[model samples]
Structure formats: structure tokens, C-alpha cells
Target chain A: MRLGPWKIDVEYGHLALVIVIAGVTGFYLADTLQVSRNINNIILVVPLAMLLLGLCLLVVTQCIRFRKHPVQKRATQLPNHERDELEQEQSPMDLLHAFLLLLGVGALVMSYPLIGLDVATLLFMIFALLLLGVRGWLFVPIYAASFTAVVVGGASRLLPYPLPTLLF
Target chain B: MLDSSAILGAISLLGSDINIWLVIIPGLLIGLIAGSIAGVSNTMAMAICLPLTLYMDFLPAVMFLTAIFTGGGYGGAVTSILMGIPGTTSSVATTFDGYPMARKGLHNEALGLALMSSVLGVLVGYIILLFVVAPLGNWVIRLGPAEMLLVALWGLTMIAALGGKRLSRGLIAGGFGLLLGTVGMNTSGYVRGTMDIPFLLDGIPVVPAMMGMFAASQLFTLVGSQFLIKDKAARRADYRRVLSGFLSVLRYPFFQLRGTLIGVFVGAIPGVGSSVGNLIAYAQAKRTDKDPDSYGKGNPKGVMAAESANSSSEGGSMVTMLALGLPGGGGTAMLLAAFAMHNVTGGPQFINQNMDIVYTIIFGNFIQAALLLVVGLGFLAVAGNIVRVPLTILIPSVLVLALIGSFAVTGDHAGPITLFVFAGLGWLMKRYGYPVAACVVGLLLGRMVESELIRTWQISGGGELAFFLGRPVAMAFAILLVLSLLQPLIMRKFTAWRTRNRSA
Candidate 1:
């Protein structure tokens, strides 16, 4: 945990920096937000400052907590052994699959306007099913029939929230 | 003092009007359908349905909204128990035990407990809301703007207290959230980062952002994971087990009622929602549980605490939205917007001004709660198969639905863009462990806080220094704010002193 001349838990460095910045910012905001008599002065004084100071203090404390614990860092950690092991170890196949999925989702978003909700959803589902390793022409009718059911029964009949008219 | 006949009319209102019944049943079914799906949330349901409410009468319109409000909550636990994904942010804690229970072949038991727990929770919340709304409204009226602001500020402390075992990181994250919250136009009439974007003029949409962080970000993580987590949950849970859950909750009606009241009261506070309600209930349940470790697992009490608070939060959330112009949750925010579109105002006076509309909502929720209990049981029985729908079918549909939901709020492209921006920002903050709730609080409260502050100042002849304090209610709120700000420090000092004593 030590690093060179600074005999400190290296883990705490990031947390300390984050907290100091937040705490100092909060301290400034609290000062700046002092209640002023003039309406304009008070407008600048209150709310924005108090919120900032409050949030700053919040970040400062949490960062300090982050410094103290290893478990808390997992989801937010930039890259340590665990994150790298999981993320970096992805095979080229996995990379390709992920890229295609992203591309597909992006494409679906684009198609939403032209195709409309029902057609677009059906297309997205069938495409996703194929990519995820589901096989056979059997899905065509099953997909179409279920898609209709979902659109007609679920969306049209049941959903209190109506879908787009999909005039096209 | 209470109007008993009006309550009877409420009961009849839900039953007699055929169109309203049509609206209520469909709204519930749709909410159930959407909620069971991975990405469709209660907010999304409400947003999409915003337009439909435009067509209905006040009573039926509010009924449909209430149906969506309660049904969506029950729907969210579906994905949590079955798929290990919480459809709503509120259900994050559910997965801790629910998913595990499902994996252990206790799916029926888990689903059973969660369903029953949810109904009981909302039922209790409804009952509490029924009694407390009048007295609570009186209390709220007595409070000043300063106190309201203080309550909002108190909410921020939750970040530092609950973020993690660490104190500093929590504050930093909260601070960053508050900073980002100010990115849009401020109360000062100065456009901050909104610069040229007209949509940005309104400030960041926290709902889209929250959904992005909680739902969309999870999709990224899910994409990263090679396989969808599946469950081989047990096929059969005896009716006895389900009945026992009811018996157990009934045995401790006081606890359930108390928890429900807390959820309602908490929910009525502007900017607080079911997520806060859920966590507060979790903490309370854990604190009071004889065996604390059993909570994070598949304990019935754990399920009971979360579901009750979470469901009850709906009633709590609506109380403010319908009774006071302020909103307690995303659904309520959208609801307030609906009221506005229809030329309705929502506040304590709104109820006084429009008792017919208000009474309809108050009584409709009670009837809906009882109905949802029956409907929820049927859904829970088959939710295993119902919730088994793949994310592949789910994601694209949700993407389309999110677009539809956002657009339904405003029949234009701007709403979708707001949804997108919020989604992206939500994903980033959630990834980095920032609190999205604070940002939401800031966004929703930002305008109101600004207006209220300005109003207070104007009333004080621009003498802003002591203007807020001059109002008796505002002064009380100011005191609450100071106390809230000091609480963390006080607790920290106490904890430190205790540790030092232990060491000695």
C-alpha cells in the first residue's frame, strides 16, 4: 500500500484528491451563498450555492469511503486486475459479437421512424434471435404470430399507454 | 369529519362507469405487461399513457393513472426475481435475495412472497394515505419555503450516509450530481450550459437520465456479460406458503401499517420516490429483524419490507402530485404534466377547488389496490413463464417503446432527444457510481426552488437576507436544513468517539 517517500495507502490518494476538491468547492459555495438583502444578490446567494456545497460535501465523504474499501471500487474502478481480467480478456469473437449488437441496436433506432413500432419491433426481435443463436425457419411464424399478439393484444388492447399510430 | 359517502362514491365510481373500468383494467394489464418486460418501467408506462389521459374524464383519467402507478410497481419485481435485473431502480435490492431464491428453485416462493408483499405494502400505503393526507397537508401548509428547501437538502445527505461504507466518495459523487444539475438554465435566468439548445433550456430530464443509468447502462453491462442469467426456480410453492406470508404480515399489521405510513409520508415529500422508500424500508426491516443476515437472502420479512414500502410509495408519491402541485416520483411528474395539459393545477388548493376530481383519485386508488391484489396473484402464479421472454425480444421493443413513451409526453422529436441525452448522462453517472437521484431532485426541484425563493424574496421587498426566515414555516424549514446538514458530521463524530473509547 506504500509508495516511495509517501508512506501512505496508495489506495487513499484518489479518494483524498476527490474529497479535497469537493470539500473546498462546498466551502466556497457556502461562503458565496451568504444571505444577502438584495433580491439579485440573494438569487445568486441561495439555492445554487447551497446545492453545490451540499453535493460537494456529499462527494467528499463518499470518496473518503471509497478510499477505505476495496469492494466499493469494483463498479467504478478504472482498471485494476479484476476489471482488466474481465474486460481485456474478451476474445475477438466476443468483441465482434458486442460490436454487432451495438450496430444492430443503432440500426434499430434509425429504422424506428420509417418502419413504425410493430414492424420495427418484429424485425428487431427476429434479428436479435438469430444473432443470439436461436435457429430455424420455425421462428418465422412463431415470431410473426407472437409479434402480432404482442402488438394487438398487449399493446393495442391491454397497454394503457398507446403505441405510435404507425400509419405507414 | 371524514366524508364516508364520498368514499362510497369512490368505490362505486371504480365499479359503475364502464369506460373507466375499461381504462382501469387495460391500464393495469398494460402496466403488468410492460413492467414484466426488462426495459419498460412505470415511468415509461406513465409517459406513454400521458396522451390517453387527455381523452378521459377527470375521475377515469386519474383512475387509469393510478392503475398504471400501482401495477408498474408490481411489474418491476418480475424481472428482478426471474432475470436478476430490476426493471426499476427501486428493485435493485430485490435482486439480492430474489434472484438467489429463484436460482435455488424457490421461484414460486420468491414470486409469491414478492407479489403478496407488494400488494400488502401498497394496501397499507393507501390506508395510511387515506388518513394522513388531511393532517399532513395541514402540516405542510404550516411549513414555510425554507422548511421545504431544508427537506430537499436533507435528501442529499442520503448520498453521504448511504453511498457506501466510505464517507468522502459519497459526498463527492453527490456534489458532482448537484453540479451537473445546474448545467441547464438556472433560476437566475442565466442559461448555463444550455447555450443554444432550446431543449436544454428546460434543464436535464432526470427521468430519462435515471432510466438510462439504471436500465440502459445495465443493458451495456448485460451485453458485456456472455450469457443471460437464467433461473431454474422451483415449480411449486404451496398455497400454504403464500397464505402464511399473508398471515405473517397480518400478525404484524402494526409493523406493516407503520412501514406503509413512513413510505406514504416519505413519498409525499417533493422529489422523494419509491427508491428512497425501498431503502428506508430495507434499513428499517433490517434494524428490526431478529435475524439481520437473513434479509439479503430470500427472507419473507425482507420481501415484505421492500414490496410494502415500494408499493406504498406510489400512494405517497401521488399524494403530493394530486394534492399539492409538487411531485414525489417520475410517474407523478408526468401526471402533473398531464394535469397541466388538461388545464388542471395540482396542489392542496387544487383539491379544495376541485374536490370532485380529488375525491375520485383518493377513492379510486383504494379500489385499485384491492383489485391489484387479486390481479397480482394471478400474474405471480404464471410470472415464471411470463417473465421468461428473452432480452433479445425485449431490448429493441423497449427502445421503440422508450421512444414512444418520450414522444407521448410531447408529440414531438424534442422529448425523444431529451430522453436520449438523459439516457446517455444517466449511463455515465451510474457507471461511475454517482447518485442520479440527487440530479433528478435538482432538476425537478430546481425551477420550483428558484420560483419559490424568488417569490419569498419578492414578498420580502427584495430584502433577501432574512426574508426566508421571516416566514414562520420558512424559518422552521431553515432550521431543519441546518440540522440536516449537521447530522452527518454529528454521526461521524459520535462513531469516531465510540471507536476511540472501544480502543481505550
Candidate 2:
């Protein structure tokens, strides 16, 4: 089944997820194995082993299911199970919009430590408001600046510690 | 035996501390508003508000938080009835009939029924909590480490059930979470999966991660929507119709009672709270009704059934948190954080030592229930208007608050960074139908599950397989786990066989 507007395959996504999890868990499992094993360490190892095993089963079963039922037909299916030609084209645009939103937000988050919280947030808000199709340059700057100031200023005042930022 | 002194002392405790009582109203108000807004879940509200609790004493902080919990259970129903959007998962079932009712211009009636049912549900849930928690606490005190592990495992199983048909995905996500949970050093100081990062040494900051997964991810999804409710005329709130709708709920006592019962029992189970309760209750009500097909089509009973069960589930969840020290779901996970903040462990020891505090929480809920009826009316009068606010403005605003809230939690860049990372992760998981709730249950309960597993292993003398046989309760749990895993698969096969035979 496709989830959300992005048309991401649920089964394949889950398979990919489990594989990554298994790989990470295997790395950790190897580390614990190398460590000297006491009774306490043995206790910790048991659950990790179980988790590793569970991930393996999840990935394998998902693979079998995927093989039994190929992805093409399911991938194209809309949530309402309707076959509308117009919507088929429309959803991809929606997906692109969603991707841009996520990318913008991600970039802003990464910038927090690099550039600073206040400056990054102000830029992010302006970008986000524009991305969401909020027109009028006058409304954009005022909304972005005021919102960022309220957040940064209010947080600086109320928070138990100072926010990580180079400039207000 | 009930302690008369504890009862009297609890009453006196509230009477003495005006601050404890004062915070409850604001807590309820915040919860009501947060819950009424779709995408601002009770968990997010509690998490965002959690930092504020750091300023207060233990009792007041907890009371305030719990008051929010109580109000939020009902607040979700408002949006469910008024708009098609469910404010919280607890209210998802409500929208089945509630929105349809609103479509028929019975919006006022639907809102009223939802409100009345919610109030009664909260009252019934806490009333059950009042009777069950103390006795349950005593019984749970006798449970050994093995049994505790089983309890944690049972909670994990509930996560799968919460995923509906996405069992494999849920289990895998939960497994990943358990692995992530062990990233930090164990009790023996052996670190497992920190990847050599200093910040990762203590493990993922749970509150920020939870806020990201539950709140921020949900907000991102709503980012495309123009407004919460598309219809302008439906957004108007009529007090007279709301009143009539409120009184109309009294007509369906059976639905309310059934829903409340379902909400309480199911909600009491760790990891399965109001979200499932409302669904099961609504299903039962629909199945048993004279016209089963009438469900999801403006049925008043459906609204009552869903609202009552979901609302009462708050009390049910509280029972688990107070008596067992295990959170029932994400909302209570935040409460558990509050407990940690207060240096208060919720369990039999805490219960026995501080019966007065326990009783105070219950009694305060009773007052909250009464206050909810009054406060909720005022809230409903204004709640409908929020649907008119555009998501473009709402999303950025809430995201900023969430960023600040996370920062407040960790008092470092770690908070905001974690929030951003998990939000992206959560959004991806949601988009793929991986069951973010399962991930949440896993992340929140991961430490407890592993800790209990280690404790059991230690008690059993270093991985002794025979040790399981000695513990009857743990053995019973083990049996339940095996059955829970196998039963679904077996039932699926049987259904296939039956369908094949029927076709033949």
C-alpha cells in the first residue's frame, strides 16, 4: 500500500527499514561480542540477539511478500481506490511540494548549529511561508521576523539556559 | 483496606496547597486547546508544557500535568465533530460518524453528544481508577523481575495490535527502537551503540525524540492543507445547538456506558490506550445497533460510543501509570517524565509511602471532571473558530514553539537537533505506514523493557532457561505472548480456508 501523498510503498519501505536496522544492530552485536562477557553483559546481549533475529525475520518475510505481490499495480493505487487520470498527475506535484517542504526544514535544522538558531529560524520561516504559496512580500518579512523574534527572544528569556545562537 | 487517614490527608493536602489547585485550571485549559487543534496531540501538549512543570513543586507539577491529560482526552472530540480532522488518535473513531453528522448539519448535536460523552467518560475512568489503583498497586508489588519483563513484553505486543494490519512493520520498528534504547552504557558501564559520539553516550533524549515523532511529523503532513476545515459555514459555533446536542447524549446511556467500560479496561493495558478503546467501542456499538449500516453516516450513537470510550481511557491509562509505574501510551510517557522530574517513582512503594498523594490525584480528577463540564462549554464556544486558521501560519508557528520546547527540555542544541532528526524520521515512517505509534511505544518503553529483561536475567542466574518454569505468572505471560504471535497467523489461514470452502 502507498502511504500519504508521496506514494511511498509501505512494504518496501518497511523492508528497507528492517534491513538498515538489522545492519546497525549487527554492528552493535559484534561490538558486544568482542567485549568481555560478565553475567551483566550476558544479560544485555540476550535482548540484542533477540532484536537482531527479529529484524532478520522481518526483512525475509517482507522480501517473500514482495516477490509474491509485485509493486507496480499497488504503487499506482490511490487511497480512495479511484482511477482518475487527472489525480495521477496531480499527486506527483503534491509529492514534489512535500519533498521541498521536508528539504527546506532539514536544511534549516542543519543550519541551527552552523549559522545560529535565531538567524536560521528567521530565514527558514520566510522560505517556508513562501514555499507554502503565501504571497505578498510585505506580509512575509513581517511574519517571519516577528515570529522568529518571539520564538528566539521568548525562549532566551523563559528557557533555563541560553539557546545556541551567534546572533539574534 | 482503605486508609482513612490517607483519604483525609489527601483532602487536607489539596486544601493546604492552593498552588496545586491553581495550576489545574490552566493545565486543563492548555490541554483543551491543544487537544482541540488537530496535529497538536495531547502528547505534544504535555511535552511542550513539561518544561514549565520544572518550575513547580512535585505535587503541583504532576497535578497540573494530569489535569491536562484529563482535559485533552475530551478536547480531541471537539475537532472530530466540528471538522473532519481528528485532533488526536483517540478521536479518530469519532470522525467516522461525527463528521458525517456535521455534514448533515447536525454538527451542533454531534458536538454536544461528543462533549457530554467525553465528560462522563473521564468521570467513569477516574472513578474506576479510584477503586482499582491502590489494590492493583498492592498486587503488582508482588510481581518479580520475570513478571515485570513479561509486562513490558505484553506492552510491546500491544504495539503490534495498535498497528492494525501492519504487524510486521510495527514489530520491526519496535525492535529497532529497543536497539536504539540500548545505545547508551548498560548498568555495568559497557556501551553498545553510541557510535563514539559524546552526546549519544547517555542515549537519545527521549522527550525531544517523542515530540518530534508524534507532534512535528504530524504537523508536516498538515502543512499542505489550506485550513483544518474547508467548509466556512460549518465553522460557526451555535451555543443553543451545542446545548441541545449536550442534552441529546443523555438519551443514549447504553452507548456511553459500553464505551466507558471499553475505554477503561483497554486503556488500563500498557501501550494500548484511548486510540484502540474508541475504535473497539465504536465497532461494538455499530455491530450491536439495530441498523449496523447506519454507522459512519451521521449516527449519534457512534459519536457517543467513540467519545465516551476515548475520554474514559485517560483514567484507565492513569491506573497503569500510578499502580504499575508503566506508561499506558505516549501521553502518559510524558507524565512518567514528570514523575522522573519530581524524583517520584510511581509504584507500590510510592503508593504505600504516599497514599495521600495518590488519593489527591484521583480526587483532583473528580474535581477536574466537574470543572471540565463548565470549562468545556466555554472552550467549545471558541474551539470551532480554530479550524479557520490556515495551516501555513499554524505549522510554522507550532514548529517554532516545538523547537523552543525541545530546547527547554535538554537545555542545549541536542534538543533542537534531536527534534529535527526524529521529525524527519517520524515523517518518513508515517509516510510509509510503519506505525509511528509503535516506534513511540518502543522508544518510550525501550529502557524499561531492557532494564526489566536484565533484572530478570540477573535474578534467574545468568541465562538459565529453566528459571522461566519457576515463575508461574511469567510463564502465563510467556504463553500469552506465544499465542498472541501465532493466533493472528492461524486465524488468517482459517479465514482463507473458510472462504475457499464457502465459494465451493
Candidate 3:
């Protein structure tokens, strides 16, 4: 992308992170002020939230400047074709794996109270194992079931509070 | 300071009871197992075992509890070195370097260094406690809100130091953590940021949040990796390397001594204990070293400094419990409960009348420290095999365990919910260049800093400058904090000047 005679490679993920930080800071700062403007109440929150917002702005500025004047590598450092191959090998599949795992965990936690911890855990384990490329349907269910049994069973006995469960 | 008659009586008391000897190993084993698990803390371990102590005698009961205390101190370091997860808050600093070392296939050495440091820390802490418990207790109690506020600020200086090349990102993460920490209710009775969650009334549950940030976040990052240690040959748990790491600790006496002293003094303070002590020690070690940048990247000194301080804090916390009947942290609070169960109060009178019992406890800790050296070696040998597990199996398993552990910590749906939310936040922060450790530190100290600052303001008649000027100790800490903040710049200048002079 070109902006005012300068070429830049913008990383959307990094930019999104900065935006998220700024949004959280703004929300918290506004909420704190709404609670009260009393010095004692807002002493820690007001200053910290402002500091975070300031940092986000500074980071955004640095990101643009650094992207505009991205560091140049010597021709002898690596052949262009090899560098391209290296970048290809890195891939984005790892990210997809992470995202899937995150979703799996979220589903398990959200369903914990509704479906019971044991069933939720068993479902999460199977989903995770499959997503991570574990094979053999016979092995997967057995492994997931036994592991869930031991963990939930042990936790049920050890923990003071009862873990909501459907099956013993 | 030495009571001659009490020392002799303590020796006799130790020899008179065989039951005390019997419970020591079991207590240590129980503590070791509990502390190595991701979410289970030494306090939880003690609480679970508290009922069993009711059946034992007073001396044996205290001895058993202290044995657990001593063992749990080092046990947290196990998972910290093997995995990125810190088993307890006290081992947070340990993960900063120990985890890096493990990733580099040096798990054996890191575990050995942690074990040796913990043993010596306990020995030195107990020795110091024996001579100066009374005086230290008196001095520590004199520290008011002003001093504690300074101490919290001193720990906060670590945020800047942890920033490395990206100082602003570190600050942002830390600031975000500070704001998040004050989520539920303020000390002044004004609430903000709770989002109407009832559990937020007590503030974010720190242990569960920590489990998400460190353990679950790291597990997410490890999804596609083949193994924790990429090189198959390097994953073996070699006893020789462990021994070498053990022997290497003796060479860094200065780091060990400094960390132990910081642990003792910081641990003696009520409401602030090993969690902050280890951070302060690690920060000081990094600041003072000739090569400060090597710290977070896997410096042995970082592990040594953190472990020594956290382990030694056991004895430091004992000074308050023994001399003033005040518990410094949860572990000591459990000990206090056991004291109540046995119908023996701990105060100046208790110390004066039962001097032998006090000495007996200290001496028993000495033995426990020695036993830890042996038992800890066996435990490390078994625990070191974590590197061999493939990431396919390890990642989901650890995530599930962390989820369960978080639930155990908070005892409700809120714990799992918090863990899930923080896991996503931690992952994003890590994917960017933000320092999660800095955020964790900020969260830990946020409530403390706010409460102390409020108290200081109230005591100083609305935050008067003259009130701070009159405090010599606070002034001293302020000066030290300023100097530490400036140390990196000064060192840079000095090095540049030396290089120019040498070239000229």
C-alpha cells in the first residue's frame, strides 16, 4: 500500500490489537468517572487508564512509521526465492488450530453448567483431539472417556464443592 | 539474642518425640504433590490436611504443617521449569527464565538449580529466624501504610525493566492489568468495572485469572508444535546435568545471599509475602547484573534469585506468626488456625513461655530443608519427563487441567468463565509484543497499591508533601527506587564512556 509516496506493509492483527486496547481503556475510564470523580476512588483507575490510552496511540504511530520505512535486507542475505519458500513453510495453519482450540474451550466452559462438567469435558476432549489431528475413532473416544472419568471423578471427591455431573 | 536454656530444651524435645519424625516425610510428600499441580496451592494443601492435624499433639502438628510449608515452597518450581505454568504465585518469576530454559532442552539443569536454591534458602532463612525473629517482628510491625506503598512502587519498577526494547507496550499491558485489578470494589466503597458480576465484588479471583494467563494461554500457543523440546535427543532427563546444575549454585553466593535477604525482609511484612518477594529479588538480580538483557532469556541467576527468595520467605513469614500471632499470608494463616486448634496462642507471652517449642519448630525446619534436598531430587527426576509428551496430547490435556483447576480455585462458574476470558486476552497480548508478566505483576499489586495509597492519604491529612518528607525510611526507599529506575541509563552511559576512552 502507498500513502503519500511511501510504501508500507500494514499488519491488520497488530492494528486490531491497538484498537482493542484503546477501546477497553476508554470504556474503563468512562465507567470509573461515572462511578464518581472523587480523588480517593479514581486515583488509581484514572491515571492508569489514561496511561494505557496514551501508550496505544504511541504504538499506533510507531507501527505506521516502522511500516513505512521497513528495514531493507542485503541481496546476499538470502535469495528471493528461498525467502519466499521460507514464508510459505511458516503458513497460517497454526493460527487456525489455535482459533479452533479457543472456540472448543469456550464452548466447553459455556456449556459446563447446562450439560454438566463431565459431559462438557468429554465433548471438549473429543473435539480437541480431532482438531489436533489425532486419528482412530476407537482410540479417541476411549481415551477421552477414561481421562474424563479419572479427572472429574478425582476432582469430585477432592473438591469441597460438588461438580455437577450426569453420570458416575 | 540466643537463649541457651531454650536451645538445650529444644534439642531434648526433638529427640523425645518419634511421632514428629514420622509425620515429616508424609507432610513433605503431600505438599510436594499438591504444589506441583497447576492450580493447587500450598495453602490449599494445608487446608485439606488441616483436619487431620487436630488428632495430633501440638509439637507434631506444627512440625507436620511446617514440613508441608517447606516442601511446597520448592514444589511449585517443578511445573514452572517443566511447563510455562507457574504452579503458584510465588513461582511466577521462576517461569520468566525457567520455562525458557526448558524450551531450550535444559530442563534438568533448571530443575536442579531451583532445587538447590530452595534448599539453601530454607536453611539460611531458618538460621536468620532463629537469632532475630523477635527483633525482626518488632521492626516489621513498625512499617505503616506509607512504607508498604513505597514497597509496592518498588515492585512496580519491574514493569519498566521487563519492557526490554518495547517499553511502551509493557506499560500499556501493565496499566491495563492495574485497571482490571481494581474491577470489583474500591477501598473507599465505590465500585467500577464489575459488569454486574457478583463475584467481582471481591475483585477478580487472582489465582484463576493467573491460571488462564500463564497456563492456558501458553497451551494455546503450543497447538501445532510437535513437542515442548523440539530435539528428540535433548528431551531426556539426565541426572548428571541435574547434578551439575546443583553444584553450579554454590558459585553464585552473592545472588543467593541477596535474594535470601530480600525474601526474609519482604516476607516478614504482613499481607505481602513470597509472591512479591520473588519478583523483587528477580528484578534486583536483573538490574544489578552486568548483562541485564540476558535475564528474561534464560539466565541461571534469575532462577536462583527467584527460588531462593520464595523458599526463604517461609522462615521470614514465621517471624510474624511466632512473635506477634499475625499471619503474613495464607500458609501462615493455616498455621495460625492449627495453633488455635491446639489451644495454644502465639504472641509475646507464647514466645516467652514456650521458647523450647519455638526453637523446636525452627530446628525441625532445618531438618526439613535437608530432607527436601533428597526428596526433591527424586521428585524432579519423575516430573522431568513432561518434555517427552507430544504437543497433540499435551496441549488439550493441560488446557482441561487448567480449566478444572480454575474451577477448583474459585469454586463456581465464575472461575471457568474468568479463565476463558483471560485466556483470550493473554493470547492476544502475547501475539502482539506486550509483556504478560508485567500485566500479571500489575494485577497482583493493583489492589495493594490503591489501598496503601488511600491509607497514606488519610494519614497525611489529604496527601501533604511534608508528611512524606518527615518519614526517613520512606525517604530512603524513595531514593532507592529513583536510583534503580536510573541504573540502566547510567550503566549504558558508563559503558559507552569506557569504550570511547579505550579506543582513544
Estimate every model's Cα lDDT from 0 to 1: 0.60, 0.73, 0.86
The 10 consecutive residues of candidate 3 chain B with the worst lDDT sum are: B156-165
Please provide, for model 2 over A78-102, each residue's C-alpha lDDT reduced to its tens digit, 9 standing for 90 to 100.
5532343223232555556666776
**Candidate with best lDDT:** 3
- The residue ranges of model 3 lying beyond 4 angstroms of the native Cα positions read A66-91, B488-504
DockQ of each: 0.17, 0.38, 0.69
* TM, every model: 0.67, 0.73, 0.95
Interface RMSD of 2: 2.7
DockQ of the two-chain complex in candidate 1: 0.17
Clashing pairs in 2: none
The chain A TM-scores for the candidates, taken one by one, are: 0.42, 0.66, 0.83
Query: How well is each residue in B1-504 modelled by candidate 2, as lDDT tens digits?
Result: 567999999999889888888988898898898777544567777988999999999888988888888788778877667655466767767877887787566776787778888889888888887778866545545667677567556645644543433566667666666667666777677776677878877888766776677555456666656764557775577788888888888887888899999888767766546755776677668656877556766889989988999988888888778877888788889988999998889866787798889888888888888888888888877765555567787677666666666676677777778877787777767665566655655665566667777788777787688888877878987886666555557656977999999999
Residue pair clashes in candidate 3: none
Off by over 4 Å in 1: A1-168, B3-24, B34-65, B76-111, B129-133, B224-231, B234-255, B269-306, B313-364, B381-383, B386-504
Runs of candidate 2 with Cα error greater than 4 angstroms are A1-19, A36-39, A42-90, A165-168, B1-24, B30-69, B72-118, B161-165, B215-217, B220-225, B230-361, B380-384, B462-472, B497-504
- What does candidate 3's lDDT look like per residue over B1-504, in tens digits? 989999999999999999989999988888898888888988899999999999999889999999888888898999998887888888889998898889888888999999999999999999999999999989988888999888777766665556435667766877777778888788999888887889998898888888888876578777777888988988998999999889879999999999999999899988778877998899889878988767776799999999999999999999999999999899999999999999999988899898989999999999999999999988887899989988887788888898999999989988898888888888877777587777777777788888998899899999899999999889888887677556666777989999999999
Which scores greater on DockQ, model 1 or model 3? 3
Query: Which candidate number would show the highest DockQ if scored against the true structure?
Result: 3
